[model samples]
Target: MLVILDLNDNNKLRIDMKKNKSSITLSSLCGIIIALSTSCSVMSKEYKTILIHGLQPQQLISASATNVEADGASYWSSYWGQVSDERIDWPSYERIEGKIATDWIWPKLKQFSEANLCDSGCVLVTHSTGDLVARYIIDNQANWLRNAGLQPLNIVATFDIAGAGGGSELADIAVSALTGAASWSFVIDQALTWWLGSDVTEAVGVLHDLKVNNARKISPVPDDRAPRLRFVADGDDFFGATKLFLKGSDDGVVASHSSCGASRVDSFGSCSRHIASDGQVGHQGNGVSGFMPNHYPMLMSDNYSHNSIRNAGHKGKVTVANYAANVGGKQVSFQTYDETTGHWFWKKQYRFVADSNRLSASELIYDAIP
Candidate 1:
């Protein structure tokens, strides 16, 4: 079992992450991009911590994947820890439903929730396999967090960056090889390790759970999710490398269709999964992205890729739109951008104006970049 890192129990991990923070930034200096709160004295409602899992680092000496909280604490702190308040954590890579996870492992999650989460709730910023672990806990641990004194805090913000909600082709191959379910000749046992690229380790990698059919089983989302759910996924990233295993568009590790959480489509162009955004004010409900029949879905785009979408708090490609509506006069305009190419189709956009207010509380936009 692997415990990643956090503020309370991970003092060592914190130090390690601080040391490597600059390296992570240098590695993805050009990474594409994409939070909140308020108060009079700016009192924090609850512990606003960032929780991350799934994509941890590999242990160099053991040829195994290191527990984020144990071995490569620096890697996580260096990367995601910088994304939010002050920290995150490590989780066991054991099969999520297995006793290893149920008995000794997942309790750590419950403990983490009880310790950090409060009225403000915590923001879940997940990526790739992190989505799978978070989905299970978010839907299943509602009562647990509530019992821990989290409150109607049942609702909270979730940011899925390059979410592998659908599943990954690499996982399919790994699962087949491990279980001997599919043709072993296609990818022998040793070859599967090669595909792993160094994940072979003492702990289970949770790849079986990431299989397509298995992953799709994670729907209908429970009704107890927050109103501000956001998913940022792309179809392509490592074109030169993904082609070897991925048959369709992928974000190096996840398929585009899977990453977007787009499960169903109709002849009429309507989709069961990718629900279009309901608009600004209409976002105060369970149905985020218009597809909340079961699971809390997200607004998606195909113009971007995975791996390169991690947020580092940079303003390189950010756009801020502020507005207030009262009688609301009329103004309308349109702009287009090809997200996949990372280029806007238009240089500028025009917005018509209506009547509004001044020194408003704040603004929250849930759109393509949400």
Candidate 2:
């Protein structure tokens, strides 16, 4: 018996098995390909979305302990629903050393890599210190996988929510309070307890990693080209307590420089290279001019707090009154609504204020997913 396959004159697949012959039209061939693509595994592409969570108060208290109830690692379920296929949970109390990424995180990632689960590509959603951890992964995952005789992850992009990759000044302050480097005032003690759920008199494990300079020193720039999309908020959820410790504009916990992926920690009002003196939301511009390499700020809101941005709850409504070419620049257009007159259009800069309805930051981020 013999078999042969070839394209017919009519652009159809003609297969001959011994004395029997059959032809499949182009549409039929496409249908067959689609049907067999699953069994043909090697030809199919699988895309996965992985969620890496931020620091937990319980983890911050003790690296060796686990408090499932206090951990927000599973909060992504509310924001993204059931889209995430994998979740990477790490102890926020561990340093970015042997145990944190090398032992704890690596095993999970290695398993996924070895399985070639994301053969096509993946989108990572990380929050706070997870952003810092992801940068390390992006920098080393490929080499680590190849060294282990496995395939590397094809990370298409990363969504960094309240990213602390640039490090938070609060970490520095916390260390200062712990080491007695700075005066341990009543205010500092209260703030740390409020945030960490404990006195946190000792800065151990990951607290050192969260220090502004230290975090920046760890894989600040990744070799991978995956873009880091940042979602930031300027609301003071901590009741204006932690804000004094942070620089410029902040999402209560992290300063805008860190959240926006600024190359250097500074007082930056907006993530864009341009800023408006009159105060307008900085719509993140493309490229690496104003931000860290491969980092791009996506959404910004005055109403969204650090915690609210990651949840499914509706914060409230906001009105976009103007659109500008750049922050602080002349407004190119404007649209405002009034109770009596309805929407009025004109030329102005981009401005968001407390008013009519708009999507929450979580919804906006979810919608932005490709």
Candidate 3:
């Protein structure tokens, strides 16, 4: 279970690392131990790509969530079961906590990258809230990186899938449904279960941040000078078949407006991803109130997982374009992906951020860096 990446420092990852001293004991971790490059022998190694999971717990995601819904073709997460160089011990089934991001994730990331990376930096592959968490780090690089014993990290790219860009209406539903005025809908319950798999009492912080107005305060800036941020959105409503559209497009989980940051010019209040803080029950505002970005980040072949049955509802296969193919004549590890095998390459490229034309992780990680 060794996941590795081998890109140069051309990509940048903007992460959020707000300091906090909250001590949560995750009493219900379900006894899952997500190992991160555990080598018994104490030795230094070079690596390229790193893995960061999103909101869904690792135990039930990818290999596990598919069990919830399968049309028969195939279903795999972009980062599920894929070996990686670095693995963040994101709570397998709990909503994110700022302390985890700052106390554990930030330090571990810097330590791992510094100890294992070559000149070629690593590629950050994130999903859901993981994308937002990383953006928080970028938003506060000085304290998170330098104070933690390193200069700014040189990330190559970031891959965001169904990111909670402007938060979700579902958050509100998850909070009130169990006791909301409306009758308890089985569909909403199921979707919320899959989302956090925990009680509302345990989700106060997550729910607070998922609020539209609250989420906007910590949302990514319009433009960041770091990595190339590439976004992928899902179309099919996998969770409870709920067509809860934010602005216009939705994937049962996240609205397309929140994912692509587009399709909200004329649609205005009706089609925006923004959900007014105060609205009538069952009434989401025009979706334009909060931050409305105009850029739609995507891959050349169009990265929309769960849109097709062939790649499974949630899995995608991308043939890494090797700019250095002639020299190596093969897929460079850390910078490439083999669709047929669903594995990331791990060869060290010693890729550095050349001042000539070095761009941020294109430019994902959050697509905010450059």
Candidate 4:
């Protein structure tokens, strides 16, 4: 005989018995019951963690087409740990205008959602260009899935590490140089090496979409409800070689405006209007200066390089910030850290000062994970 057990949302258990040559042992029944009981418990809510990777040229040229968490975890695995249930891998070399989304990414997301995300809910973890990929998905997935007569994914939120959603100035320089519109310079060589492994003769494909103006044009405002939490850095691994070509403060590869999810592409110091990139006193007021709709800059570090921010082992020094959602299209302050006490003070206890508050990047990321 074949026996099966299942649990519904009501916590009620259902058993199915089917005629078969295979028999079920008493121990096996007990194990099944125990597993179901533990998994279906009211206190324990099941959730899947999904990872999306960024610009990796190597992934595009590989013999195999598909790359998943099972194939190998992303660089973020150090902090996220071995917790990825699924991964959305795409050909990084292709342009964002191509069928990369429909062919390479959407099918995997649809399958994963139907199989796991619809029931379990999921958290999206993305890095670099993956942030841009995620924004496109978040904006379109609901209507697309509904049209196909499929249930939309239950996405809790997105964690964007060194996000490039606002695009980078380096891409503009690259495209200009490759097209001969602008002369090639040392800045282009070093910047391309940092991002693509070497200086290239062509700046076609994904680089086209990564241009500062082009990226903003694609998705200026998101319609999705899921919150986008940005993790940004200011340290330049290139030692000022690539920084000169970039606008404002940068983490070698991406500028603060892009990584911080600013409303517009411009020179910016920090995520907050109240704090400068140099940790000096900055302008006051909650007025919208750098915020993208539904985008929040959660953590930042002047000591963290673009590569170091994702590695848990690095333990780079960082500062964390958060704000309440838009009420009538205006953001409100939520909490502030008191450096002396080493504790966060709520709005009611607002004692915020424009000073550098230090903490480990890993510590902040670990505390924020669901």
Candidate 5:
């Protein structure tokens, strides 16, 4: 006999069977296991979030040695920070190499599959050169998802901060300098040695090869049809100058010109229909303090520089606010607070409106995703 336990949560029920029953058949136990497993599976299969850090070679070391816990989000196991070995590829270099290597494919695929938090789908939170890696994963891992019995649903969201979505002008400058087109080979070499380590020559060569290969497949403009939540900060030093130097438009660190799609506003306009305006929030001034001030040259000088801007201490609030405004439902809610005051700014419970425009890059990512 099956005893039904009413789980307080509607649509969920638990079952209990008496242990003393000698007549309990194997088929009956199988039925009970199947029922419980199905319920647990449904519970486990919900919208999951993953954080993918970009281009730091050091992350690989940490992943291998540290008891890294989930930072409230699944972290792709990879070395993404500084490196002691010059021969090892950094995050940026590895991404390019991984794209070329057939074996690297399974690791990325498994990373996503094991983090099956997104029964409904998932959101990819990425930063800097990491956005390129995210794109590479999405483009190449479609087969992996199919094999794992998972479907790529709405991206749910994407947060790209100071992304080098378009190629870096600094990269161009380095190439010119090293190739004798520019007169700053000595200075360029010194800078590379100082930041990228003594192995600058090999790193640069690897970067160049990756860039060339990436150029063939990826476009500056992301597909409009893909449902995404995006954000861009204004004072982004890299895109801004890159816009002038490469594409001829300002994108904080990455030039909008180099970016594959329309200008920021234009891209927003096209995707605005999918973005929910009610979920929108905007910030004024440099997103963070303590960052160096030089705009154009910073991209080349500092490895951390980018064109994206985000509000200080307010990213979480903005994310919660935007998610609720654009894509609300029982599974979603909104929350906000002030950094300086430590005060609640906004809080609400709501469901997504189907007619709302999808969240844009300007809405969710800039200051928050990191």
Candidate 6:
């Protein structure tokens, strides 16, 4: 005989057994005990966190595929240390493009909810284009939750790495360079080759269409009520072009001119603000930087060139640390650590807490924890 427990609320199970009084024996009883123990082990499994990876060409190449469970726990468990389910590679961009609509993203959320993966709102950590995709899904889901009368999940925090939050200026430049009859620069051609793949002409054409048809229809985000937006650029980033791109006063390859938008709260008449990484962290360091004098690298690298900032994982870690340290507070903290010594060798903290009168408060917030 075999017994099974149904974990889902539907409360159903299937079992296979032979009913024979003469055949019942001590061996069968022992087997049942062993099976019950195994079932208990499965039911008791727990996860400390959930991590969703950024967009990639294929599922196998995605960050989630590398070390799914462990990566989630390391970067996204919680600020105060709590156990939670870690979801990875769910409804990835590769899956989205193949499906031709973003509808898949929501189903994964529903799946997580049904499975009790995110009891509290899950912390979302995304990179590059994946950041935008995730945001789109969340925004849509929030709308759905409101309509369905479901309690909104608590979004602890969002960690967007080198996100193309604002439109990419390099993308604009590439489209302009390709559309006109003007002579194409070798650098531009190489960039198209590297980033968009071999079919440079067609890729540029598609990008142009997307920008003109889709991007133009979207209104700019208002300044006062923009979403809880934060920027992590490389001082030397070339791909995103933080060095070549200039916001009103900042230089992120994507440009604050294009990236900064009205906060989501602004639409609701709520007060909010935008944040950015500190100085000495531009396109290459902690800002956005591209290689080949233009394109930004994906993560951290020692080269410290235009592309280096995006390539360094440490910068993304810094951004998350800053967000965690300042939750419910009006400050952002940043620090740099030594690999070998495992100590914070340098630190720069900022406390931008404002009072009811919109004045700076005396509360002190450190940039570096250590």
Local lDDT at 315 for model 5? 16
The models' CA-based lDDT, in order, is 0.43, 0.69, 0.41, 0.67, 0.36, 0.34
Candidate 3, residues 131-181, lDDT tens digits: the string is 566566545654566676666655545545556656666765765664464
Give, for candidate 6, the lowest lDDT window spanning 10 residues: 360-369
Please state the error at residue 1 of candidate 6 in Å: 40
Give stretches of model 3 more than 4 Å off: 1-47, 57-83, 92-97, 116-119, 178-187, 190-202, 222-224, 237-240, 262-296, 300-370
Task: Write the number of the candidate with greater lDDT, choosing between 2 and 4.
Answer: 2
Give candidate 6 misplaced runs (Cα > 4 Å). Answer: 1-101, 145-151, 175-183, 199-201, 204-231, 235-253, 256-370
Q: What lDDT tens digits, residue by residue, belong to model 1 across residues 4-50?
A: 33333322222135335311221122233111122211222242535
Best prediction by TM-score: 2
Better of 4 and 6 by lDDT: 4
Report per-prediction Cα RMSD to one decimal.
12.8, 10.6, 17.3, 8.4, 13.1, 13.9
lDDT of model 2 at position 348: 44
How much lDDT does candidate 5 score? Answer: 0.36
How large an RMSD does model 2 have? 10.6
lDDT of 4 by residue, 1-370 (tens): 6666554555455556775333333334444566544233322324466778777655534426636343335555665544456677766557665766877677976797577554656668788888898888888888878898888787767878889888888888878987899987776777667666663566666778888888887756667778888888888777687787777778888888888888876777778776544333336343228578888887677777777776665543355455444322323233444333234553222233123234345445534455
Where model 2 places Cα greater than 4 Å from the true spot, the runs are 1-46, 67-77, 273-289, 317-358
Residue 140's C-alpha lDDT in candidate 5? Answer: 47
Better of 1 and 5 by lDDT: 1
Q: Which stretches of candidate 4 lie over 4 Å from their true place?
A: 1-46, 59-74, 276-288, 323-337, 340-363
User: For each candidate, what TM-score against the reference?
Assistant: 0.56, 0.74, 0.52, 0.73, 0.45, 0.46
What's the lDDT for residue 198 in model 3? 45
Colliding residue pairs in candidate 2:
276-328, 322-349, 331-348, 331-349
Estimate, for each residue in 319-354, the C-alpha lDDT of model 2 and write its tens digit: 331222121121122233332222456434444433
